[model samples]
Target: MSVPQAKSPPKAFDADSAQRALRLARETLQIEANALIALDQRLADGDHSIVQAVQLLLNCHGRVVVSGIGKSGHIARKIAATLASTGTPALFVHPAEAAHGDLGMITAHDVFIAISNSGEASELMSIGPIIKRMGAKLIAMTGNADSSLGELADVHLNTRVDKEACPLNLAPTASTTAALAMGDALAVAVLDARGFREEDFARSHPGGALGRRLLTHVRDVMRSGADIPAVSADTSLSAALEEITKKGMAMTAIVDVDGRVLGVFTDGDLRRLIEHVQDFTKLSIADVMHANPRTIEPQRLAVDAVAMMEEFRINQLLVADADGILVGALHIHDLTRAKVI
Candidate 1:
């Protein structure tokens, strides 16, 4: 039997090959970035195609039905998601699926966004007549303005790219980037036109950190009732320290008999007092407290409280009611724990 030689494991690795690979990747990225810049210039030159597309979707009483094939289909799916998340109701309907039975999803009141790089995708072209017959308005996003799908559209958005980033010019690279950028532009314009606020976005995304920042009120995360570290102005320094220690907060609030906040005594004050006063135990909390400390209302958003804390260079704030009565308290750690920061 001839001795079989294991073909020397194909050059396990090559430093030169790795460097070439990185260079190619960087070049491709630069090309795609340049394509986006070109698209931006086209839009800035008074191209009303993007604005028209937004108006079409805005005026539609029904959902935005996005359809495309192949790579364009992938871009259509992403655009649909962006539109839906940002307040416009949208969903993707694959062109091939529409040819079968998904066409039932389209209605006269709906607005159709058909994406095709060449404006000649067979599946999209096949549905063009049926979409028109249904009386739905068709908006075409394509590189070829005179192609079949473009001719069939009520409005056309030209997503033409000067060149593809692919070395062979056969892959969808720059064109796809331009389409994505156009989709983003459409979504943002509609978002602004509809007056979509951060709170509205938070309502749609209640499980995310942004939702917590926009939706959580100061009272929701503040320590209230007995958990608040509070002491009377006449309270001895030792007793105030006990209140802070028992409450597990680094500070204590000095309040009047009516529960109105007079000032705050914090760990920083304790440190300063230790450095200056030889008999801290004999002093009252009023002597060591900082008067008119930063405060927020219970109804204020937690994110606003975080801003106040940052602006005032403090870690905690007292939550006061309309009458300036201390109802609760919050620390920077509270916002951190709530993921509002």
Candidate 2:
């Protein structure tokens, strides 16, 4: 009885397959990590020109205009978004389009952030004279500090990488990643310097999940008036059960004569009551209701409600006002529908 049965045959391992996957993943991650480290090294120790450039953007009453071409253009767009969301006003303007009419997007009070690998992109160079003539500060992000764009800038942010991550060594993989990281560093530095809070960021990202969770309150998603499943405490169990069934909610609130919540009864209660008590019509809902149920304040943020629901592992909650009178009810589904979860 103590003898152990032979272990099942060990799963086969293809060394070639495992090594190929691991090699690719490690190589890619190593390239990106190295590029980021190099970018970090280029940042000045303290309040320097690049730091001052970010400060300038933060202080500008106008917007930050970001421009680049090709892969750098894509990175510039993301950087602009990061800046805008983190409290610095910013928008992306394609270098080519700027030659037509997008240049109007850039005003004298705005700051210009231009990206180029060699610091000699033709499109960026074409708009250079105009940007300078407008008296807008030009902040350059490039690998070549001596190139035309760099020389024309008010501040230079070096995003140089020794080599490209692509096997051909001609693609802009490492350089773009470094540039993006450097851009992020600048935006976040400005954000921290300005003491930008989460609520501020949430305001900028109102359509996103974190924004909804932070800004949406219980009243924004609660079932109100006719939508709420509720009945008076003196109501018979059958009537209360009918209310819950008609509203399609798992539970119904039991209220007193003054419309104040007294208790709650759920599907679980119905099941238990049915098993032990058969006189549903004769029984009063108050006798079997759960008193002092968990509730949330109407003004509480949706994120707080999510936390409470997770902690209690419940799907619904009652919302009360400052006076503890029932205002509304909320279900977990409501949060998901509002994209607040």
Best of the candidates, lDDT:
1
lDDT of model number 1: 0.91
lDDT of each: 0.91, 0.88
Question: TM per model?
Answer: 0.89, 0.84
lDDT: worst 10-residue window of model 2: 40-49
- Model 1, residue 14: distance off in Å is 4.3
lDDT of 2 by residue, 1-341 (tens): 59988999966668987897789778877998898887766554442666777777777878899989999999999999999889888899999999998898888898999999899999999998899999898999999889999999989888888888787889899999988988888888899988999889889888887788789999999998898898998898888889999988799998877778888899988898889986777888898999978899988998889999999898888887877688899999998899887
lDDT tens string, model 1, 243-286?
Answer: 99999889999999999999999998888888888987678999
Flag regions of model 2 displaced more than 4 Å: 1-28, 44-47, 278-282
Model 1 quality (TM-score): 0.89
Clashes of each: 0, 0
Those runs of model 1 whose alpha carbons end farther than 4 Å from true positions after fitting are 1-23, 41-47
Residue 236 of model 1, lDDT score = 97
* Candidate with maximal TM-score: 1
